[model samples]
Every structure is written in structure tokens, then in C-alpha cells.
Target: MTVKQLSMPDLVDACVQLDIGHVGLWREPVRAYGLEATAKLVRDAGLTVTTLCRGGFLTAIDPAERAGALADNRRAIDEAATLGTDTLVLVSGGLPPGSKDLRGARERIADALAELGPYAERHGVRLAIEPLHPMYAADRCVVSTLTQALDLAERFPAHQVGVTVDTYHLWWDDQAPPQIARAGAAGRIHIFQLADWTTPLPEGVLDGRGQIGDGSIDMREWKGYVEAAGYTGPIEVELFNEGLWARDGREVLAETARRFVRHVIA
Candidate 1:
């Protein structure tokens, strides 16, 4: 589960009480709780750390800014290593402020990955470039498609750099199926998250995620595609909707469990 709406302890408790085998954690809560403490907590509970939420945003024009981003990612890599998870999700930063050079932004990502790839390998961590939907291309994430994520990942060994497949971000992409197969073949499909798409998006479009099977996307097809591509990892249910987060976290977790079986695993 993402740590955006719950304290780390609450998150861990809910997961344990529900017998959740794996969880995806964000960096902020992990830091706030004391990295070692949080890691130990999850370890003692016997839950697998699925993937660290993020470690990218490396697309910057300013040299200092770029350097700072790389340094931060190094720390993130160290954190993932400490947490006993090899996958560190990377959301390549969006366009530089007031700039329209999308190509330049993508190129900068390649450069940054060239530098950070070795660092991640040394830490025994794999960097997964998560391409946000095209809607987030300007403000949140520049890598906007699975193909693009794979392209960046292909530049490095699969073990060092990989890609994340989030159904919410990729359901609209017609090209995603072939790329998913390719990612699996190359051993670069590091993490898979499920979030259904819904309309009437909230402002900023960041927190409008829907629950599984509640939207238009065919989740069974998504699961079939990924499985056909040879991905047999934990399928994380990630929701960012404000409405959902406002409800009881345990209720949300219970419903998520129901939907995962009904819609994703069926």
C-alpha cells in the first residue's frame, strides 16, 4: 500500500491484520518513521517490500539541480537496499519550468540514467522507470509510455534499469501490450500496479484514481498480458482518490482485497 493517506504504523498494522503478503512503500513515510525502524517493522511482520515508490526526477537543465537529483537518487537507492527491496521506482521528472523542450528533457534522462545506472547496480538495486500517462507529461513525469520506459531501460542492463507498469497510467496506451511482452522478455518488468481509470478527474489529476473493476479498462486483459509476458510478481493495488482515502483505511483494504480477486486475479 502507498503511505500517502496512512501513518506507517497504521499501514503495517492493516497489512498484517489482512494477511497482505507484500506492500509498496513511498519514501516520505519511510523517512519520517526512521528508515531502519520501518524496514525492521516490515521485516518482522513477514511482508515483502514490493517496490520503493520513487527515485527519479533526474531530468533537469541546471547542472546543480541535476547533481542534487542524482545525489538524492543515490540515497534512495541506498534506502531500497536497506529495505530489502531491489526495485526502486523512478518517475523521470517532467519538463523544466517554463520550458517546452520535451526532447531535451528526455535526453537529459538518458544522461542521468547513464550516471545512475552504475550506482544502482553497485547497490544491488534495480531502477524502474515508471512512465506516467501522457497527461502528466508536462508537470509530473516525462516518460509517458511503456515503450519509452523500455527504451530508456534498454540502454542499460535489465538488472540495473527496468520499467514499471501501472494499469491506471497505461490503460489508454494501445502500444502497451507489445512493450509489456518485450519488457518481460528482457527481464525489465520490475513492478506492476493496478488502479482503474475514472472520469471527472480532480484538479491536478493526481488523486483521481479509481478502484479495480470500477472503471472502463479490462483488468483481466491487463493481467493476462503481463502474465503472458512472464511477469509473476506481486500486483499492487494503488489508489490515490481523495474520496477513498477519506474512508476508513481498513474498509478500503478489505474492499481492495475483494476486488483484486474478482477483477485482477480471476
Candidate 2:
């Protein structure tokens, strides 16, 4: 959500003005704006919904909690289908409360996927399991590497489940390149996203994603990796920086598009 500050209508206008044909949408804004209305808005603008931001967090020890998570993901899948997006990015959840069992937690995610994957397929959507950085391992996500994400996704059919290659999280791992190829070979590279890592991470680290070309990542290099892996899909720039959000959103959207061209496409 690089331009989360923008209202849906304003964001749509910005994308159209910038000639950005495909837009990746997060569930919160779409739900808030009324899902059908948003679907219509983007459809009317002739903009493709690239992928839906999230539909995971399936790690829970309690049965009720686990059931609720699956239900929520089902709703997310329905929303993604309604939005006409084929991909649903998943941030697989972290450890259960007071639980030190990382392996147990991950297995639970697989269990949830076993049920959700087929359901998603029936709804004409695919689940893209996104591994967060290891730093988020304890609380936000346990799938902290592409290898780990692949291990989980491989249990299901490629058309039903895959992995999300997000540079912000995977850029630190040298093993990621090979994993990208592995994912591509199986036709499981569902979506690729770009975000840079800056020094002196912000207070809560979650919103610390740097703007493209403003940090250490070689945007072009990562783009090359995904391309080499045969991922011919929309490349989304998803920044979470509060600094960018504090500024005008339209300006931020325009600036991000320019940065994408200069740093990644040029």
C-alpha cells in the first residue's frame, strides 16, 4: 500500500492519470469503500486488479481461533474474486500464544492451506504465501524465507497455491534467487512485489519499507531475478513507510511511478 493515504477514488484517478493499468489492492480499503463499488470503480476505469494484499495468518493452537482464521480467509478469497483478481497474497501467521514451537506453528499453516487452497481454487483464486523477514518470525510470520514458503506451498497444486516474491522481505537471503527459479519452474510465482530496505529502521519496523532506489536493494537486480524465473506478471511497488504516507498521496503515487521507471525499468 504505497499510497494508502489516498482515498479509493483518488487512488483510481491517480493510477489512470499515471497510465498505471494494474493496481494491487489491500482488503481494508476495499471493504471500507464497499467492495462492489470499488470493483465497479476500478472496472470502470479499465484498471486491472493485480492481486489482493492478504488472506492468511493461519497459525493458531486453539480450534475456535483456527476455525475463525479459515473463515476469514474464505471471505478474503470471495472478496478477491469479486474484485476480479486471481491472486490472494497471504502473510502466514506467527506462533500461537505462549508457544515456542515454530515447527508446530508452520504445520498448522499447512493444515489451513489444505482446506483453503481447494476452496480458493473453486473461487477462481490462487493463494500466494508470502514469507516475511526472520525478524517477524516470532510474532508476525513464521515463514521467513522463500524456501520455507515453498515447502508449504508445494503441498498443493501450483494453480491453487504459490509464493509471493517480495523484495523487502527476501532481499537479504542469497538463497532467494534459486528459490525464485524453483518457484517459477513449478509455475508458482504468483506475484512479485518491490520495496527497499533502509538503515535505522523505524520504531515499529513494519512501516520501515523504503522507497525504491532510496535504499540498499538493487531494484533492477531483483527484477532480473524474477524475470529470469519466468514470472511475467505485474510487478507491484508496495512501500509501507510512514514518511511517504505523511505526504500528499497523489504526489507519492506519481513519485513512486517515476522511481519505478528510473530505478527498475531504466
Candidate 3:
């Protein structure tokens, strides 16, 4: 949660100095710290950049805006390549202002991918489409379900485009297990993230993610499902909780590791 007041140097120090092994990076912080420097830092620390936070916002209605998103995503792909991570998480932008054309927005995402997919392939990067909770369908991600993500991902080469499985977003869906298996079978499961689901979602519902096992999500079950789907990559513990953010970053990192083992692994 570097976006929640933590600096990149501190975040990197916490991971490397603390022997955390891996980290997921956001674009802004990477840019702010100088992308090459940050990449060198991580590499020198022997840390793995499991996935870059995001790339796609390809759901705009205006042709010009959509083009801009593509350009931005292209830059994101280049940055990811520089960071030495192949997976670039994609939070496809939500509906255009005052627009209810969900279908149109999704279609735009498909179209944009058609253009960016080849570019990503050339750079040896994969765009992992993250299906945010349906709650964000109108404002954050038009792709609301794993099935929908797969639907779009299947349209492109598996290596160039794929789907992200984040417990925080897909834990409540009844079809998640099957969809995960499907993604794995297709070789389209790019990254796996962990964040528990909790009540009293914060305003805008963006930063209320629960620490692992602190809420209702059955993380062990999902972990099993994900592993069963042949996903053996790093399981990123990504929490967006205000309380956690308000605490010492080291403490939060420690607790996240403990919970990940106790709830997600043990």
C-alpha cells in the first residue's frame, strides 16, 4: 500500500531489509523514484517484482481519451519491462461519466487490447486484466467478474493478455473457483493477490480492504483453488486498510506476513 503514505525507498527497504522476498509496485511511485533506480534497487536487493500495479484504463467512450489510455498503457508496458516483471496488472477504467453503456465500455476495453496486445507482446509483457468487485463496475473497472475478464482475455493470446485473481475483488463470487481453474488451464492466470473482505466499506470503497483472516474471506479455500489451478507464483498480500496504513509500515508488513502464513498458507 505505498499509495497509503509509504515511500518507495522505505517500502523497498522494508521488503529487502526485512527479507520479504518480493513486492508489487505502483507506477507513480516507480516514476517518482526514477524507474531505473528502483529497478536496480530491487534487483540489487535480490527482490522480485511480482507484478506492476496497473496499466489499462481502456474503457473510455471518447475516441481521443481511449487513444490516450492506450498510449499511457504502452508506457506502462515499457516501464514494466524495465522493472523486469512480465505481469502488468490492468484496472480497466470504469464507465465514462454519466454513461450506463456497460457493454460499450467493455467493448472499448476489448478494442484497446487488440491494439495494445501486440505492443505488449513485443516487449515480453503480459497485461493482467483485474476484475474489480461489481461495486466498482461503474467507476473503477467495467470488468466485474472473472468470467468477464476471461471472456476478454480469451480474445487475445494468453501470453500477451491474461486475468488477475485478487481475493478482495473476486472472493464473493460463486463462480470464482471454476473461473480460476479456467484461467489456469488456459495459461492466462498472470498474478494472484490476497486481501480479505470486510463490512462498512469506506467512502468510495477504495481503501477498506481487510487484513488476511481479519474478515470473512476463506483465504485458505481460495489459495487451494488457486494452487489447484496450477498457479505457483507469489501470492501478493495487498491490503488497502486505513487502520493498517495508519500504523507503522514495518508492523503492518510483519502482520501481513503472519496473516498470510496463518490464514493463507497454514
Best by lDDT: 2
lDDT of 2 by residue, 110-173 (tens): 9999999999999999999999999999998999999999999999999999999999999999
Candidate number of the best TM-score: 2
**Global fold similarity of model 1 (TM-score):** 0.97
Residue 252 lDDT (model 3): 82
Question: Candidate 3: worst 10 consecutive residues by lDDT?
Answer: 1-10
List model 3 lDDT by residue over 83-159, tens digit each: 99999999998989989999989998999999999999999899999999999888889999999999999999999
lDDT of 3: 0.88
Per-model CA lDDT versus the true structure:
0.89, 0.95, 0.88
For the record, the alpha-carbon RMSD of candidate 1 to the native fold, in angstroms, is 1.1
Write down the RMSD of candidate 3 (Cα, Å).
Answer: 1.2
Task: Please identify model 1 stretches exceeding 4 Å from their true place.
Answer: 1-3
Model 2's alpha-carbon lDDT is: 0.95
